[model samples]
Target: MNICVFLSAADLDERYTRPARALGELIGRGGHTLVWGGSDTGLMKVVADGAHETGGRLVGISVEFLRGFARTGADELVVATDLAERKALLLARSDAVLVLAGGLGTLDEVTEILELRKHGLHDKPVVLLNTAGFYDGLTQQLRRMEAEGFLPVPLDTLVHVADEPADALAYLERLPTAPQVR
Candidate 1:
């Protein structure tokens, strides 16, 4: 499977690094292909490096604007002219998405993908790697949306949550195959 991971470009404290690396390793060992923001810094780098070290197929996608600042031109990268283009390519190429601890950018990406799924644009699975309960508030907010009938999606379609990397990968592996549309 081609798995797209949404993560921040900002330098993360050790709290976020460890799990990101572990998640990369697990995904690598599972023989899944990795797709992520092509950044050689922060948690993005940690995960990319971990996957590379484990001999996983790593494909990086980066926007032209961030290429110089992020210094992420890995051999596997597919560059785009803008963030939106990069995201569109990633979503088209990935079979699923794994979101790690990140800031606003990560949230935006996840929400966009979720909205895409809601509109029947895609049926890929999205999982939130909730390391140390970092996403507790967001999950609660989702629940609130469900209660208010603001979400037309089934609870299962929102996002899968896992406290650990291994668990997240396992859950993804068990997801029911998307049905044929035609």
Candidate 2:
């Protein structure tokens, strides 16, 4: 599968980078492609490096201004005109979306992804890899929204929250055949 990963572009500590690397390596070892923001720094770089070292395919979606920072050795790289275009291309080129720890840009990407899925724009499975409880608050808020009927559909129908990379991979690998309930 072409697994798209939305993650931070900023340098972070090992707490964040370790799982990101592990997830990337897993994606590669499973014969999946790593589609990402294309930045060659921070967790993006770490994950891509892990994938590349394990013989995984890399597909990077980068914007025009950030082209200089794009990964140089990706199997494929596409430069979008803007962030919107980059996001669209990232979604278009992948079969599934995996979210690792990220900052503002990552947050923006995930919200848009979920919103689109909520509206049936796509049915691609979205997994939030909650490494080290990084997304604890966000998941809590999402569940609260579902509990209060703020969401149009059940939260489980929109995305799956996985605490570990292995869990996330297992949930994703079982999809379309066995749907996740929460």
Candidate 3:
């Protein structure tokens, strides 16, 4: 399966580096493809490196302008014209999506995926790796959105929250083949 991971481009602190590497190794050992942003910095580099260490295939999608800073680890590189195109290609090519601990960019990507799901565009599984409760606040906010009727559907129907990388991998492993996003 091709698992798309949304993560920070910023360097990971010790808190996240270990698990990020583990997640990458898990994907590699399982023979799953790692799909992600094509940057060479931060968690992006870590995950790609970890996966590559185990001989896993990596697919990176990035805006054309970022190619100069893109990493060289990806086995396949896809250049998109803009952010919108990058997001579209990321969603379209993945069997499942993993949300790792990150900053604003990660939030934006996850929200976009949820928005897509809300519109009945896809039914693919989306899991949030809430390492060390990193996403607890966001999860609460999502619950609040649902409670306030701001969301079109229940939040759980759109994303799954996991506290560990192994757990997220388990969830992904259990998912059926991804359906085509409309």
- Top candidate on lDDT is 2
On TM-score, the leading prediction is 2
The digit string of per-residue lDDT tens for model 1 on 52-148 reads 7786788888888788644344547888998789889989878889999999989999999988988889889999999989999999998898889
Give the local distance difference test score of model 3: 0.88
TM-score, ranked from best to worst: 2, 3, 1
Off by over 4 Å in 2: 177-182
Q: Model 2 TM-score? A: 0.95
Question: Which lDDT tens digits does candidate 2 get at residues 157-177?
Answer: 999999988899888888764
- Error (Å) of candidate 3 at residue 148 is 1.9
User: Between which residue pairs do clashes occur in model 1?
Assistant: none
Q: Order the candidates by lDDT, highest first — what do you get?
A: 2, 3, 1
Clashing pairs in 3: none
Find the number of clashing residue pairs for candidate 3. 0
Q: Among all windows of ten consecutive residues in candidate 3, which has the lowest summed lDDT? A: 173-182
Off by over 4 Å in 1: 69-75, 178-182
For model 2, the run of ten residues with the poorest summed lDDT: 173-182
* Higher-ranked by TM-score: 1 or 3: 3
